[model samples]
Target: MAAFTATCCGRALKMVVFLARLVFQLLAVYAVVLLLVYVCQRSLQYFPDKNHPGDPKESAAPSMREVELRTEDGLTLNAWFAAPVKRDGKIVVMYHGNAGHIGHRAVKAQHFIDKGMGVLLVEYRGFGGNIGSPSEQGLYKDGRAALSFLEKQEYANAQLVIYGESIGSGVATQMAYEIQPRYLILEAPFSSAAAVAKKRYFFLPVDWLMKDRFDNIDKIGGIKTNLLIVHGDEDSVIPIELAQMLYEQANHPKEFITINGGHHNDLYDHHAGHVVTEWLEKQIAAEEPAVKPEE
Candidate 1:
């Protein structure tokens, strides 16, 4: 009995040692993964297309001209600009999702232009044949450059509508909070890049590993402008729950719309443009001064 007990004890100790080594190895591998994630998070997050988005004239938006916007960082980015139709007189500054360049957005942009709203399709650094790399601060500089161009055009904050799509919502949120545009619209926006990364990389320590937080949830409260949050009920990319969370935290004078079967990129096909146009017009009318009958 004593000999048998000794053998069993030895076996148990060896098993424990093996398990400890395995756990240690896994932890080491995970740490390496985390390091790699931290370094390459932006590359994974921003999927830009160096290929031109195609010509605006080809996209049926003949008024949009290829223009150069100078950033505070001294980088001149290629952007699309169009003055609003005289009837509408509203300038819409659009920051597109982090994917194919601004040209991919010309179709929806034309919808706004058709409504007589001027649109500025701002392209970021390192996107659409523009020079430089993309980062949180770099994108902000690009946004500032867009606004500066508008400022030079004599457009007031009240005449401006700031729009962001997907990741671009981060840029839009920051700009709206800073400038207080007439309306601020976000489509399929994540609460923050860290939150989205955590969703996709549940196994990793994303909150700490992510360098660009985007942190839209934290900043939404600071936005006092008229806010519009749109999400698709079936949005698989950035779940509607995230949009709901954002809307819940937003200030009043805000609106939230859920497309019945909207996905990340197809909201436009689901008549999202119509929704935006209707809401913008309603908000504008409500804010317009009442016309009293002449005495």
Candidate 2:
């Protein structure tokens, strides 16, 4: 009987070891699959040329001078600078959203130029025919590089206005901490990238695992510029309530405009450009003009 019991115990131990090894293999496979999915989603924007300019007529507006910028990582970023017939040392550096490149922002940029302000439309690291992939850190570097490039030009002394739309808001907020633009504008922004990810992938525990935080809510309060937030009440992607939450966190001298009947992609549909231009004009007009010494 003792010999029989010993054999049974050995058999149980072997079974436990086999089950452990099988579980380990399953986990290893799961990890690799998860990694592959992440890499694919992160790189989906760079593959194929889907972001090209769909409307050629967008170029019919006043042409903007093309500007090329280099990030700290040596990746080239493309930009378009539309200066007034004569610049008065005021520039608006606009950052495009995650979906399309700067080509989609031509109408918005023209409105700024029409308002007597130089507009700089910057492409993120991987978007708009730029080299490398788009990440939170890369975008911050790209935005700073654009600002540095602008600082070297004739409008170096111009008041800098930073504008960001959609995912670009996070980049804009990070740059605000670094460069402290004279004015900051965010359109259809989210509270945080993680927050949006959580909403989209509620089935999985992605909020904690996501390497890119893009936490704009944390960075917005530190910005020392006049903040202007515009959002569409009918936004289907990011709720308008979150936009209000972000606006409320801002300090004094901040404004919020709700684009009537607008959606996430149609910010310009309900007079967004006109509303933004009008607000910018009033803000710029309110500031005390810089005193220049007569030669």
Candidate 3:
């Protein structure tokens, strides 16, 4: 009977050991996965060349002139300036989404030009074959540099309109907070990069793991400039809810426009340019002093 009891105890001890080994193996695999995610997190966040053609020259329009901007951090950034056919003394400094170079946004520039507003399509450091890598701070520097270049051109602060698309919204928010442009527009903006990352990578601890926390929500409250947020109700990338949340947090003189049946990349197809141009005209009219009847 004692031998039987001893054998049973030995079997229980072996089972416990086996369970322990299994747990350790599982943990090791999980740790390796975490390591891999950490190493490649930035790559997932930024896609500078996504859908880009082989030649950067293809992105330029006939009226688009190449401009060189020098960032405060000593990076030479490339930009395309599409002057308005009829100058309205207003310029839109466009900060494009994460993917692709300025060429991807040339059409948007054309839209601005057609509206009699010039466009300064600033390319981030790592984008558009520019020098230096991209990071949250690096993008901010790039934004400031673009603004500085514009300032040197003697455009009044009231004539400068800041426009951000997708991830560029974060950069634009930071700039608007600091520089306080006459008008600020964000297209399909997220609340924060961390929030989006958490949703997309629900299984992982993305809040702690994300490096580029473009916390636009925290900064939007400080932007006192006139704001316009254009979002697609059917956007799957940066959901419309995020844009709504941002609009709610923004100060007065803010407008939120939702395009029906518009997805993430096709808001332009849904008359986004018309909406923007109309809003811009309203703002410009508001700035003009009331015309008094001639005596």
Best by TM-score: 1
User: Which RMSD values do the candidates have, in order?
Assistant: 1.6, 5.6, 2.4
Clashes per model (N, Cα, C within 3 A): 1, 1, 0
* Model 2 residue 87 lDDT score: 59
Question: lDDT score of model 1?
Answer: 0.89
Worst 10 residues of 3 by lDDT: 50-59
Runs off by more than 4 Å, candidate 2: 1-33, 44-60, 154-158, 289-295
Please, what are the lDDT tens digits per residue for candidate 1 over residues 226-270? Answer: 899899999888988998888989998899999888999999999
Q: Give stretches of model 3 more than 4 Å off.
A: 1-9, 50-61, 84-88
What is the alpha-carbon lDDT of model 2 when measured against the actual structure?
0.79
Q: Looking at candidate 3, what is the lDDT of residue 254?
A: 91
- Tens digit per residue, CA lDDT, model 2, 1-295: 9999999999999999999999999989878866765766466322323453433335734478677887788877667777655556468788878777777788888888776777888877667666677777878888888887877775553378888888888888888877777789999998887777777767546754677778888988888888999999898888888788888888878999998899998888789999998998888778867788999
For candidate 1, list the clashing residue pairs, or say none. 84-118
Q: Give the TM-score ranking, best first.
A: 1, 3, 2
Q: How close is candidate 3 to the true structure, as a TM-score?
A: 0.92
C-alpha-based local distance difference test score of model 3: 0.86
